[model samples]
Target chain A: MPLISQQQKAVILMADDDADDRYLVQVAFEENDIQCELLFVEDGSEVFDFLMGQGKHEEKGSKIPNLILLDLNMPKKDGKQVLQEIKALPAYHHIPVVIFTTSKSPEDVRQLYKMGASSFISKPSSFDKLSEVVRNIGTYWVETTMLP
Target chain B: MRKQTLQFLYASLAAAVLLLLSIGVFTFRSLRSLIEQSDAIAHTNKVLFQTEEVISTMKDAEIGQRGFILTHDSSFLKPYVDATQYLGRQLKLVDSLTNFRPQVVQRQRVRRLFYFAQQRDAHIKQLLAASLEPNRPDYDLRLIALLNRGKATMDSARIVVDSLQQTEKLLLEERIHHKDQLSANTLGLFTLISLLAVLMFSLAFYLLIQEIRRRQNYERQLEKTVSDLLRTNQDLEQFTYVVSHHLQEPLRKLQTFSTRLVQKHAIELGDNARFLMERMGSTANQMQTLMADLLVYTGLGLHGDTTDFEVQDLAVVFQKTVENHEKQLSAAKAMVQFDKQSWPVLGEMEQLELLFSHLLQNSLKFVVENQRPHISVHTFVITGEQMPFATQSQHDERFVKIVFTDNGIGIDMQYQDKVFGLFQRLHTADNYPGTGVGLAVCKRIVKRHNGYIHLAATEVGAAFHIYLPLAN
Candidate 1:
C-alpha cells in the first residue's frame, strides 16, 4: 500500500441533483471512515458550468470535480445529455462518470454502461444498504481502480 | 378449388360427349354404306335367280312338248300346260322387275313367239287327225312354214332379251358407281366431323387445365402473402423488444445518481442544494416510470396464452385494485365508493387489475391537502344502439359505461392531453411525487380492452368516463 496524498484525495468529484441523497452519501462516507470529498450539482447544466469554471461556480481556486455522479432525469439538463457533452468535450473527457439512480430498469443499466459510465448503482432503499454501496464504490474508485 | 374441379368435370363430360357423338356418326355412316351395298348385291342376286328360273321353266315346257310328240302321254301335256301358266306369270314378273325400254321390247317379242308355237301345235294336230288321203297330205308344208315363223320369232325374242340384259347390266354399273360416290362422300364428312370434335374437346380440356393451374397459383400467392405478413409481425415484435431494452439502460443510471446524492450530502447541503436534490429525485423517479410505461406500451399488442375468457364480474377486478391501493387510500383518508353488484365484463384479469389500479391511484394521489377524498366506481350496461363504438369510437350504438369519479384537485382542461403523455406532470415536484405515466398506462390498457376513457364534467373534483364495447 502507498501513502495517500491531499491532492489525490481531492481528485474525485460527484455531480448530483438531489440534496438528501448527497447528504446520505456523505453520511455513508463518514460511517465508512473514508476521507474523500464529494461535490454536487443541481442538474447537468450546472455541472457543465462548474466544469468550465463559469456561471455561479466561477471563482478563484475553485477546483473542478474529478468524477461526476450523474442523475439521468433532471429539468434543465439530464444526466444522459450531461454524460454525452462531458464525453464529447476534450477538456473534461478524461473525467470518469458513475451513474447513481433509483431505477431498476435493465435498459438504463445497459445504456449508461454503453455511454462509458464507470459504474451504475441503484438508490439504496435502506440506510444500511446505502452505507454498503458507498463503501464498495469508495474501494473501487480509490484503491482498486487507477486514476486519469 | 371446388369451383375449378367442377369446371374440369364439366369439360371432361363435354369431351366425352363429343367423342361419343363423333364415333356414333362414323358408325352410322359406315353401317349405312354397308346396308346400301348389301341391298345392291341382294337385288343383283335376285335378278339372276329370277332369270335362271324363267330359263328353267322354258326348258321344262320344251321337254313336255318333246315328250308329248314322242310318247303322246297326257302327263307330259299336263307339265307343258303348268309350264305355260308359270311362263306367263314369270313374263309379267320380269316386266315389272325391268324398267329399261329394251326389256319391254324383249317381252313383246316373247309374246309373239308364244303365239307362233301355239299355231305350230294346231297344224300338227290337224295333220294327225287327217285320213290317209291326198287332201290332207301336205300338212308338212304348213308345219314347215309354222316352224320357220316360230324359229324367227324365237331368234328375235332372244336378241331382245340379250339387249335387255345388256341394258340391265349398264343400269347396275351406274347404280354401283353412284353408291360408291355417296359412300365416299359420307365417310369423308364423318371423318371431318370426328376430327373437328376431337380438336374442340382437346382445346377445351387444355384451357380448363390451364385455368385450374392459374387458380392454384393464386391460392399459393395468397398463402405466401399471409406468411409474409406473419413474418413482418414477428419482426415488429423483435424491434419492440430491442428498443425497450436499449432505451431503459440510461434511465436507470439517472435514478441511481439522484438517490446516491440524497443519501450522502443532504445534511451538509444548503436549502438550494436540498431543493435541487429533491428535484433530481423527482426527475429520476419520473424517468423510471417512463421507462416502465414504455415497456408496457411496446408490449401492448402481445397476446399471451389465450384460454376461455368469459365475461367476469367487474366488481372483482375493482375490489382487487382498491385493495392494492389501500395504503395510499388510508394515507389520504379517501372514501372510495363502489357498486358491489357483480358487473360482468370480458377482460383479462391481470390487465384489468392494472388498469383499475392506475385510475384509482390517480384519484387517491390528487386529493386536496388535508381534505378527505371521495371516489366513486360504478358500471352500467347500455343498449339500443347507444354503444361505445357508435357514440364514442365509431359513432355506432350499443355500449357499456364505467364511471369513475373523484373529489380531488381537478386537472385543467388545457393539460388533459399532456396528462396522458409518458412522464407528463401537471404539478410541481414537491406537491406531487409521481412520474405522471399512470394515466398513460391506464389509457393503453383501456384501449386494449376495446374501450375509451374521457374526462367527464366534474362540479368540485375530477370525473373520468369510460366506455367499453358490449358483447352479444
Candidate 2:
C-alpha cells in the first residue's frame, strides 16, 4: 500500500528498435532527475530474453521488472507479439505494459489498448517534451498506481 | 448528352406506339365495314335468284296448260298440277327474300306478280276442264277465251317481275359501288399507315442506336474515372504512410539531438552555435508538425473502409471533442454555446470528432486579442433540394447542417477561397501559430462523411456551415 519513494529504486524496462530513441529516453530520465532505475532493450527479442531468461540468458528466476515500455516496430518479433505473449502468460500478466512508439495513429492506439496496454504514449520530438512525458509517466505509474 | 438521348428515345417510342395503336383500331373498323358490305351483296344476289325462280315457276304452269289444250292428254295435265303446287311456295320465297324496308318497290311488284300468276293458274284450270268435255259445242269458245286471258295475265306478270329484277339490279350496283369506295379508302389508309410505321420505325431505330452509343461512351468514361480515382487514392495512401512514418523519424532525431546538446552542454556552447542549434531544433519541430498535419489531411480521405461508419450524434461528438479541449479552452477563456445538441448524423465517429476538433481549434486559434472567444453551434434539418449548393438529386434526402459561429477574427472576403486550401496560411507564423492544414483536414473529413463544410458569409465573425447525412 505504500507509494514508491525516490530513494527506493524501481526497475523500468524499455524496448525500442531505434538506438537513438532508447538513448534519448535514457537521457530524458537522467535530465529530469528521476531516480527510477531505467533499463533498455534494443528490440523485441531482447525484451523477451531479459524477461523469460531464455536463449543467451542462462539464469533462471530473474527479477521481474515493475513495468515494461514497448515499441511497435522491431526486428524478429513486434511489440504486438510481445504484448500478446506477456498478457497471455499468467506469470507476467500482472506487470503493467505501456506502449511507447512514434506511431500516434488512432488505429494503433485503439488496437494496443484493446490488447491490454496499460498506457499508450507517442514519442515526442524534443528532449524537453520527452522529459516532461518521462516525468509524468514516472509520477503516475510509479508513484500513484499500486503494483501487483 | 445521355439525358437528351434518353428523352429522345422515350419520345420516339411513344410516337411509334401511338401510331401502331391507331393503325390497329382503324384497320379493325375498315375490315368490319368491308365484311358487312360483302354480306349485303350476297343478300342481294339471293333476292335476284329467288325472283327469277318465281318467274320460271309461272312460265312452267302456263306451258303445261297450253300442252294439255293441244293434245288433250292427262299426262300433260300432271305438269300443270305440279306447277300450281310449287307456284304459291315460290311466290312466298320471293316475298320473304324482298321483305327489307329498302325493297318496298320490289315488294309491291312481287305482290302484283303473285296476283297475276294466280289468275293465270285459274284460267289454266278452266282450260283443263274444257279439254275434258270435247263433245260440247261451247267448249271451244270457252277454251279460246280462257287462253287469251291467261296470255294477258302471264305478260303482265313477266313485266312486273322484270321491273322488280331491274330495281334489284340497281341496288346491287349501288352496293358494289359503295364497297369499291370503302375499299379505296381503306387502301389509302393502309398505305398511309404503313408509310408512317416505316418512318416511325426508322426514327426509333436511330434513337436506339444513339442511346446505345451514348451509354457506351458514358460507361467507358465512368470506368476511366473510377480507375483514376483508385490510382490517386492508392498514391495518396502511400504518400501519407511514408511521410508519417519514414519522414518523421529523422526529424524526431534532429529535434532530440539539438535539445540534448543544449541540455547536456549549456555552458560550453557559443552564442551563435546555441542560436543555430535552437533554430535547427525549432525548424525540426516545425517540420514534424507539418508532416503530422499533412498525414492527417491526406489520411482522412483514405479511409475507404465504409464498414466503419455508424450513426453518430454530432452533438455527442462535439461534446466529447470540447471535453478533450477543456484545458485549452479554459486556458484561452473560450466559450462554446450550442443551440442544438441532439444533431444525429451518419459518419465514422472518430472522424466526426476530428472534424469538430479541428474547427474548435480553429476558433480558438483565430481569436482576436483582448477578447474572450464565443462560439455558437446550431443545427437544422433540411432536404437535399434546400441545400444551398447543388448535390445529388435525391430531393427527399435529408441533411443535418451544423452552423458554427465564432466571435473570432473572421477571414477576409478576398482570402475566402484560399482559406480551406492545404498548406495555405493567411497570417504569418509570428502572428498566428498554425500549420494551415486544419481546415483542409476538416474539408476532407466532411467529404469522407458524404457531407460538405462551406464558409458562410458573415458580417461580424466567422461562420461555418457543416452539412452531414442525417441519420434516421
Per TM-score, the best of the predicted structures is 2
Q: Which of the CAPRI classes, incorrect, acceptable, medium or high, describes model 2? A: medium
How far residue B27's Cα lies from its native spot in candidate 2, in Å, is: 5.5
What would the TM-scores of all predictions be?
Answer: 0.48, 0.70
Q: What is the lDDT of residue B30 in candidate 2?
A: 96
Error (Å) of candidate 2 at residue B437 is 2.5
Q: Summarize candidate 2's per-residue lDDT along A113-142 as a digit string, tens digits.
A: 999999999888878889899999878877
lDDT of 1 at B241: 57
For candidate 2, what is the TM-score? 0.70
Model 2 regions more than 4 Å off: A1-13, A23-42, A49-67, A128-148, B1-48, B59-235, B238-242, B262-269, B299-357, B377-387, B390-403, B445-451, B467-472
User: Candidate 2: what lDDT?
Assistant: 0.84
Worst 10 residues of 1 chain B by lDDT: B125-134
Complex DockQ, candidate 2: 0.59
For all candidates, state DockQ relative to the true structure: 0.03, 0.59
Per-residue lDDT of candidate 1, residues A53-108 (tens digit) = 78877883356665677777676888888888888888887788888876655667
- Per-residue alpha-carbon lDDT of model 1 for B408-454, expressed as tens digits? 89887777667778668888767887767788877877777767787
